[model samples]
Target: MQTHARRALATFAVAATTGVLAFAVPGAAQADAGPSTVRITEWMYKNEATAGEFVELTNVGAAPVDLTGWSYAASGGGPGQVPLSAFGEVGAGESVVITEAPAATFRSQWGLDADVKIVGGVTHNIGRADDVEVYDAAGTLVDQLAYNDQGTGTVKGPRTDGVSGEPKTAAALGANDASQWRLSVAGDDDHAWAATVGGASDVGSPGTSRFGDGRDPRASDGGDGGDPGSGAGIDPHWADVRINEVSSDNGDTPVGDAIELVNTGASDVSITGWLQIDSGAAASATPFAAKLPDGTATTTIPAHGYVYFSSTKGLGSGGDGVKLYLPDGPGGTAGTLVDQVSYTAGQAGTDEGTDFGAGAFARCPDGTGDFTSVAFKSFGASNATACESPVTDPGAGGGSTLNCQPEAPRAPAPCPPPRSLPRPGPAART
Candidate 1:
């Protein structure tokens, strides 16, 4: 009875449609055609990867071209793609892995560089140590991966390293020869650290690996513009919020409600302008821009990983009240602050309320205890009826504890552990 007693809040809906536009591959390109070069001949078990685990891809030129949807990025994050029917064709020279969880658990060891044999449901899981990057449809990033771990000073894989001279053979997994490597904070020749080769890393036989060079040698034009400059921008301390206590179904109404952004840090932040919901209302407000009314704008937030937003795209379905804009500053306002919530109607149960409910949306931004500070419930309720944040009221938990609940319906949580890049000692002559 008061979700909007004040009135006057309309201008913030610019997303008629903008989702299919990812393809940026460029740290080094030389060959061309349709599927004529392909690379990456080995990789079977990355020592047994288990901190967050991993698996990668790339190389569809020298005659392959069937890596399927082919997508991965995380040095700065964005474009996970890889659902090319799951995996089948991959001919020519060959090379396309992608694994960390699904692939039939390891179906006899992940298989397929040419050995063939991977036919179950075909959309497994894919996640172990994310923060990947490998666009190329037209978005253009070409290559990038680096969670942490260079060991021998610079080796995301076995691209050859007689001693950091870099160039042992296999072209170092760059230019598309997949080998599932991942390492770079600005080390090795810097192609962002290209190596990639997934499908259950047991990679032939090795002693140490993890490289994915290629951070931007000026290949330029990653397309898909919302503009964070494309360097993978980020700074609010890495942001990483969660807040979800409920309350805000009718009065003061801004529109449904929900939050969650987590990147923690490893590079790639660009929620575009940050602030999923700052209610201070206007110290400099505009913040929330991971955008997804269908316009889908999330560029990258890997590191610790997390990217949800809600207010009833499901559950009891009852939106209106999330305006955190900033896309990247230029004029739309700069967008600041960083915390807000109050969506009850149907209170996040499904329709994809960004996976709300089930409790989660509080990582602590200011809104205190129990987290997600708002209150008011009753939409189809049942996680105890949801709503928490508000105890003694230390500012009311402006935001932070990582809360997220909409009314149950959960089953999509498998990516979080990547953070280990630091071993490259020398290499900068090209």
Candidate 2:
């Protein structure tokens, strides 16, 4: 179904170049500045046979948006328009799902208590390319997305088989730019679509307002609406920090297998209670070290600062995995995984096959780029420059090691002398 309202690729390119899609309303003091009211945050036209397809809309505005006359249609206008008037209205920061699945199925799969408009019989184009358009009662185009298997606009390629299109961040520029979208990750809770419907993997956060992996824009705000020191509206989570370098194969000196972390966030992050887990072919992840062993308040990573942790356990010269967890309390728990990277033996990047390599996989663009091989390893230093020489023992030398002491050091008690004389004297007196 092709629509005449389809935007040209050239127009989107221009808009992206000029940053026009991110235009803020004059004097509008909001956290983000893209869509003012309702936006198509996520949508999935393809799914397992009985799973059903859905289009999720999010109310980004501060006030409720009436759905009295809002409608959605596919490009070429084949499936016709699905009127949302029956749902009444969507409150601020809320989401609504328009699906062909039964209400029970939709609720079970997404675990959403929000409005669900079930449109049966209408068949949306599930082909390589299609369009989703949303319009108000006044016939004004609110938002439209035209996706294709062949890279279109800012999107690099087609959506993976089971993956749904999700915004990279909450403040995504617009649906016009493919770069603003990413494949959804598995939700933290079991209520995820993947958990209910058996599939390749749970690829979208259907019910949650933000991305399921906690990559949502709101997560960056530190849970404070708009605090000054709260990362300046940026989430200081694991995604803000990158695993810049990893030395998996340190030969005999296992401690040399260090992992370098860099704070790519806008503000300093206190990693006082963070834990690093090394899962070596083990199904269960074990705590390998702590970011702040002493539990001191001074353990912080300044904005863009670098910190290296020498491995206490040997990392497989072959395939191995490492995870950074942010515990809710003093020590991390199973649910506190912040960031994870898994590499195959002799390969680079994570288990997903991204940025594959050997020796040390260092970030190409320092803190915020893809990981690649470094000619020379840099311990406790910037990854901007190529390694001049091999780093043999990252912790053994003068280089600073991440203090992994399980407890704080205490002064030894003075040895007690001649306790036997007191015991004999006490027995006699008794």
Candidate 3:
């Protein structure tokens, strides 16, 4: 979805991509996102009913923002666009709204299924729920929102006919807009993005956000709390793993490897009986990697020090498809597992383990599951390591350093059908 953030004097758009098509502008970073000198204070309803409610986009920027020929609509559904050319240029901090219908008739005309956005040439829509964002002029994002059917807030309507307190007040908007929002579940990315009090924003909340504890808005019932990172007691800890080297031709499995682990947590995590591997599964349904047997592995995680492990000679020759399993903890089932990186056999060098990229995975040659690089800034070393083992163990010590063969790319097979894990629906705002 698109998200826009307002700066002190500028606003930039956030770009997202799907497949080969890139949506929004490219290379726009938060830093590049200037400022929005203007801020949208609140939604103004023409009538007691919010059906006629219109968003006021104030230009707090230094220069005037052209609203000429601009169009606005509800995100979900409605008449295509509402022209704003008649409204003209919105001076810095000056408010302008393009409402196409009368107050009482608004809902009948451009109901809630619609989205309101700035449209000139390209089409961009705001997030459907709370803390959601839409791309601003510069493609930045504005967040921190409250949406419909909130557990902690009030809900507004199809349109409230009763005239109450100051309509634009944050409290009033929260009360009214809250119910108007649709309940939503946290996405797999563990995030939820939706509308706030203002239709001008594209900001959305995340699964971990205080607002992400409820149910899907579409659900007939109020809510059913599920979703990970919501309440499940998986303590958030940072673990660093490194890939020193890889080997080829080890018994049945052509690909064998070793990884280093470092516990960045305050407490020592016992990985004694644990195993590790990447995501994705092969035909046999076996996870591709593991931690070496307890004796063969490093047991205690010395706070910030490092631990190491080797795949159980089962990881195929290529890279990726790894996971971690701690088979001995009190609640030990399959321990937390993470994906490191995608490896290309022939393209990478031999023996010398490539450096994992930057970000969370930088410490390890294997990229973090998030796919952002964290370590191995070296040029060639940033690539994967290709090893070829003619015989099992040369008995060579030094942490199972295997002589890697250079180059060999594996062909991907057809992916199996989609299958759901034991996971449940995402968390809702509670």
| Best candidate, TM-score | 2
TM-score of each: 0.24, 0.49, 0.32
* Local distance difference test, each candidate: 0.30, 0.46, 0.28
Question: Could you tell me how far off, in angstroms, the CA of residue 45 lies in candidate 1 after the best superposition?
Answer: 31
Best by lDDT: 2
Residue 183 lDDT (model 1): 21
Per residue, candidate 3 scores C-alpha lDDT tens digits across 1-430 of 1231112001211211111111132332222223433333333221112223334344545587675534334331222234446546655434433332342233222222112232222223222122212234433432112232112234221111111011232232222233333211112121322121111111112112122122222112212211122223433232332332332223322122444454544665544444443323211122222333232334555454444444543333322333343232224433222212232221111212321221112223222211223222222132232211112211111111111111212111111111222211111111
In model 3, which runs have C-alpha deviations exceeding 4 angstroms? 1-205, 208-256, 282-298, 325-332, 335-339, 347-430
Please, what are the lDDT tens digits per residue for candidate 1 over residues 4-107? 11110010011101211122334434333333333332222222232112343434344445544545443233444444345656554333445444444433
Cα lDDT tens digits for candidate 2, 61-113:
77887878766776434222677786577777766666656656655554444
Q: Which whole-number lDDT from 0 to 100 does residue 95 have in model 3?
A: 42
In model 2, how large is the Cα lDDT of residue 28? 22
